[model samples]
Target: MPCELCNAFENEKSRIIYSDAHVFVVPILHPIKDGHVMIIPIRHAENMKDLTAEEARAFMTAANLAMDAVKKEYGVTPMFLVNGWEYRSQPHLHAHVLPSKTNLRGLYAASEGVVGKIEASVEELTITADRIRVHFSYES
Candidate 1:
């Protein structure tokens, strides 16, 4: 099955926070808070469990770096998570990074008609990716 994330990843409008030969980080479309990021392998995998050891390491490293960048920008570490359903979502592997000081509830709420909420949709993701891109100016 085609994964929605794969389509999102290809969306140039999506916020691409960071990208290297092996991995890329983008903002979450439905962010829990202001600085929600997602990390994925440039070479898609079905799920985290299926990632090769090297791929796993690379993804984690990118996630950590993204987290640091979010902290630097937002003054909060934001919550982080990863989810995969073997039979659903194409089993693609991805990690979620959210920046918030209060409860994580802020991260999962719907974006409609909300104030001070950050949604990681294509447009918003692009803006956020640009913000994070500024911090990681030192490229590979």
Candidate 2:
């Protein structure tokens, strides 16, 4: 089967908030909260160990940028979640930058579920993506 992150990376429809040689950052299609985003490596790394040195550094850089943006945008230091194995929704390794009080991967594993649907609309995603991209620009 084709990798989801690869597809997303190649898919023109995907809203990429930030990107570099090693990784690309995008807002999660189904976020636990509004400001939640993902820092995904370009390679199909299923786990942290799979990432090379450059990809790891790029991933961390993306994480830092996403966290900084989330803090600046939401006024809160968001949670960083590294999902893998049975807990991961997708095969590609991606770390979620969540701005919610609740822990995601663990909480989702143990609890009944989250409070409500976090599926963002296309328009919302577009606006959110645009807003986030501004943080990476010198204009911001």
Candidate 3:
């Protein structure tokens, strides 16, 4: 079975902040903090070690834009996180754009994913995504 994150990314019902042919950014189901977002490569590459140069670049672009958008839409600091679990199911490459003001230790303590006190609404997410696309994406 595919990882649930892949399925969640496909569902338009979820809050999507950014997307392109090579990548997409969606709200974290298990947010590590509020305004938390996930920037994912379209192709399933396990982890950083597995990502090709092109794929890494594309994902980085998405991550950079997602962080800017998140900060603009919600006043909070964004943290980029990647946990590689080769032994885990569906080890795809994904970047977590988590926004938080709390200290580092308190940040990782939330097992279920820290829910950022501020979350982007569906409309806000769309707008932020569009803005990012216009400013940074090739299609822009």
Candidate 4:
């Protein structure tokens, strides 16, 4: 299927509260609260490190605009979350915004959202680091 986020932007999905060429702010498909929404890059960035400068700016703009609206309408602080790299769901970069009453707790179960550590011994770390070292060069 075409990516849901891209489809949303192209088709101008009803859930969208704000949009620009590079970003869209829309409610989560399954919201934890009435005002929960996501600020997403329209261009389908799976990770923030992959976002272009234009998309980054647009993401920030959409986030501010959407969060301000959410806070105003809901009359509360808002919680924000971003997942990245292997810990993230792929093919879309999205920031979740949910209204917070006292910022006491999150709406979702901790197990559902928590990312567990990938424990490695020093031997394993050294092996991984050796493989990754080729991507960089030291200053002369």
lDDT of 3 by residue, 1-140 (tens): 66665565677434565666777887654444456667777777667778778777778888888777666656676778775354233466777776667443233454334344333456655554454444333333
Worst ten in a row by lDDT for model 3? 103-112
Query: Which scores greater on TM-score, model 1 or model 3?
Result: 1
Highest-scoring model, TM-score: 2
Candidate 2 lDDT over 1-140, as tens digits, reads: 87878778777246898888889888887766677788888878888889998889888888988888877777778889887446577888999987766445433344346553356778877877887777764222
Question: Where does model 4 exceed 4 Å of error?
Answer: 84-90, 102-140
Better of 2 and 3 by lDDT: 2
| Worst 10 contiguous positions by lDDT, candidate 4 | 131-140
Better of 1 and 4 by TM-score: 1
User: What's the candidate order when arranged by decreasing lDDT?
Assistant: 2, 1, 3, 4
**Candidate 1 residues 1-140, lDDT tens each?**
66676676577434576676677887766665667677887776766778778888788888888888888877876667786334123356778777868444444565445555553456666677777777765433
Model 3, residue 35: displacement in angstroms? 0.3
Instruction: Please say which candidate is ahead in TM-score: 2 or 3.
Output: 2
Stretches > 4 Å off in candidate 1: 84-90, 102-123, 137-140
lDDT of 1 at 113: 58
Question: Over 4 Å off in model 2, which ranges?
Answer: 12-14, 84-86, 101-118, 137-140
lDDT of each: 0.69, 0.77, 0.62, 0.60
Positional deviation of residue 116's Cα in model 4 after best superposition, in angstroms: 21
